[model samples]
Target: MLALLAAQLTLALLFGPASAQTTGAVKLATFKGPVTPVLAEYIERAIANAEVTGAAALVIELDTPGGSVDITKTLTQRMTSATVPVIVYVAPRGAHAGSAGTFITLAGHIAAMAPGSSIGAASPVGSEGGELPETLKTKETNILVADIKNLAARRGEKAVTWAAKAVSEAAAATADEALALGVIDVVADDVPDLLRQLDGRQVIVAGKEITLQLSDLPIETVPLSGIENFLNTLTNPALAAILLTIGLNAILFELSNPGGYVAGVIGVICLLLAFYALGTLNANWVGLGFVGLAFVLFVLDIKAPTHGVLTIGGIVSFVLGTFILFNTSELDVPWATIIALALATGGFFAFAIGKALAIQRRQPTTGLEGMIGQTAEVRRALEPVGTVLAEGELWAAESESGPIAVGERVVITGHDGFRLRVRKLTREA
Candidate 1:
């Protein structure tokens, strides 16, 4: 054992600096949008991947507005307990780590920021998506402030104070300001510069100290898998709303037409995706109810033929419903998308209703009912039971009053099984 240890020490002295810098690797993950459940899952997966690959560190490039508080808490826990160092880089010019992003940045094993980037706004919002009422807001703010303070304590007194202020007042600072205040360790221009600055930095991983040998190490950017990417995209509130509306329209069209499997299938799939997104977002149920009501009005208008009156009402309902569907500031559907969907929905139902009315006005072409009110010629004298030609087909006939002569013009009044009920027409003498 002593001999092996001596040999290893000799080799370390010979090639330590050069090999250490060149042999290290980094696993990079970029989060460029809101912090959703999908994002949290992605981070966890990326961290596991990095650990398995034996990478020196996992660097996350983050830029986000905000997202679910529960998801944010899960992410913070993951970051603090990661097997390897977690470096959170708030990147690029004009980018921000807002709300939940602030919590994540502060939780990093080694927090960093790129030039021009800012971080803050850790306030917790109400279920309605806006600022909580005074009492509830105070409670929520206190909870978040305490959480932030704990995360920032090791950084310094100034960082701890600023972190609490960020939760309470939504305070923000640029990269330079953050660095000066010890909110972040370093500010860099880009990833390469960040790695350069990160080389030889001491960080703790799972309670054990580790030094990052990041200089010139190869970086593998981990991206979301196909399914993850699709699910993550669904978390966009605007896209989810549009998808729901489109899905409903397709279902209604299929219901009105019947026998169209394609529309129904597509509608169901889209609705499933929309519902999944809504679940992740914790969307308001009352808003969903209003949207559902709008669709019901649209369907009613099509069935009852209301001369577009109900369609107009449907449009108003849909627009209003969409406006409130994601009432919270945290969950937003663009007004332009809502207006476009409302118009499209109204027009689609209006066309369907118009077609329904047209069908109602047309003469019946096929069915036993079509034979009624038709002029038929008596083939044989009807002694209450005889034969007649109607609709180009010979049919057994029954006379209503008296026997009818052959070639006499009769009006078909009704049908009883295969026999036609007829009334002879009297010619003026």
Candidate 2:
């Protein structure tokens, strides 16, 4: 009886932890926007955590227009090889897994979509959103076709054919259509509905087949870290452009009026972040050059008297550059934002020029130069020199015309080392 008890205890010790781990809560993470490196890291972290906890499944609520191909490959490889089952759900009614997003959705152990959601449109385009050259297009399309076909092969031949077409022809499908084509496993209304439908469904994870018991499992949400969120925000084309503009202006201001380090420091930080976003988005160098030229023109307008001509040119260059900067099929900046920023920049420079012109035309207000043109009252009579009350102070003065009587007004013509040269004021009448 003691030996039997020992065997039972040994069996319990061997299987208890495994059972508990397999029955743990489900993990959910929401991913929205472009599939950049920051978001890639977030998804990787979530997958790792789910594997460590032995959760029932890791559900990624996906909403993206897609992004970098290299990053997409990295994400797909990670998801496919993850120890935990990964479910890619295109959710919240209107989301679509386009471009690189298509590969990521297909790489999931279980793919799902909500009503009105779509999938596909995985064709490759140039960094600037134009069609690739013939040679390059053929090469890229073939490789992508092969990769996507492999990912969709398990679904069926129809899915494989459709996946190839998605890469080659840029085909897309709605949730119902994808489900009918076997491209997706289910069309769920939401997370809860997804779990309910996926429960008892068997999926192959990391080469091991297991049934997902998600219906009864508690769901725990995993949110992006603060740094991740900030980096992700920097990926926005409009925001990045705005940052670049502000950074350049701040740096210019610091250079023009040096001393305080606040503008310089902020400029550096913003520039670095903007550059990061630009690199991630693959911005056109020509567009950047145009933007730089616009600022140069603005500075020139301030230094040289152009009467707002250069400012107008700068506004045009700025608007054109901004449009070109984000002229990609997937990344488009709003025209209103670009126009407004350009107008505001032009107005600011115009105001600065107005102030500069005013200063140039105004008379000096200090020192001997400032005292050259003033009216003074004679306090003492002078044959050639006398004391005069000038600028509310008594000063020794020499008369230029002739003898000037006391209380007579004189116009200051010049100064001679603490002495004022004056002439009698002629009555205008």
Best by TM-score: 2
Whole-model lDDT values for every prediction: 0.85, 0.89
Residue 129, model 1, lDDT: 65
What is the TM-score of each predicted model, taking all chains together?
Answer: 0.83, 0.89
Model 2 stretches with alpha carbons more than 4 Å out: 366-369, 375-400, 403-409, 414-421, 425-429
* Best-performing candidate as measured by lDDT: 2
Give per-residue CA lDDT, model 1, range 1-429, as digits (tens): 999999999999987743543365888999888888788899999999987777788899999887888889989998898888899999878889999899999989989998888999777886546567899899889989998999999899999999998989889999999998999998989988988998988887887777788886889999999988989899888988988998898897788769968999999999999998887776777788888988888888877735677778888888887778776555678889888898888888888887889989988877778888888898988987899988788899999968998999998888888788889876741
Per-residue error for 316 in candidate 1, Å, reads 2.1
Candidate 2's TM-score: 0.89
Error of 2 at 187 (Å): 0.4
Cα lDDT tens digits, model 2, 1-429, are: 999999999999998755765698899999898888999999999999998887888999998988889999999999999988899999889998998989999999999999999989999888766679999999999999999999999999999999999999999999999999999999999999999999899888777778788898899998999999989999998998889988988888788779998899999999999999998887877788889999999999988866688988899899888888865656877888898789878887788789889988888888766988788999998678999998889999999989999999999999899999999999971
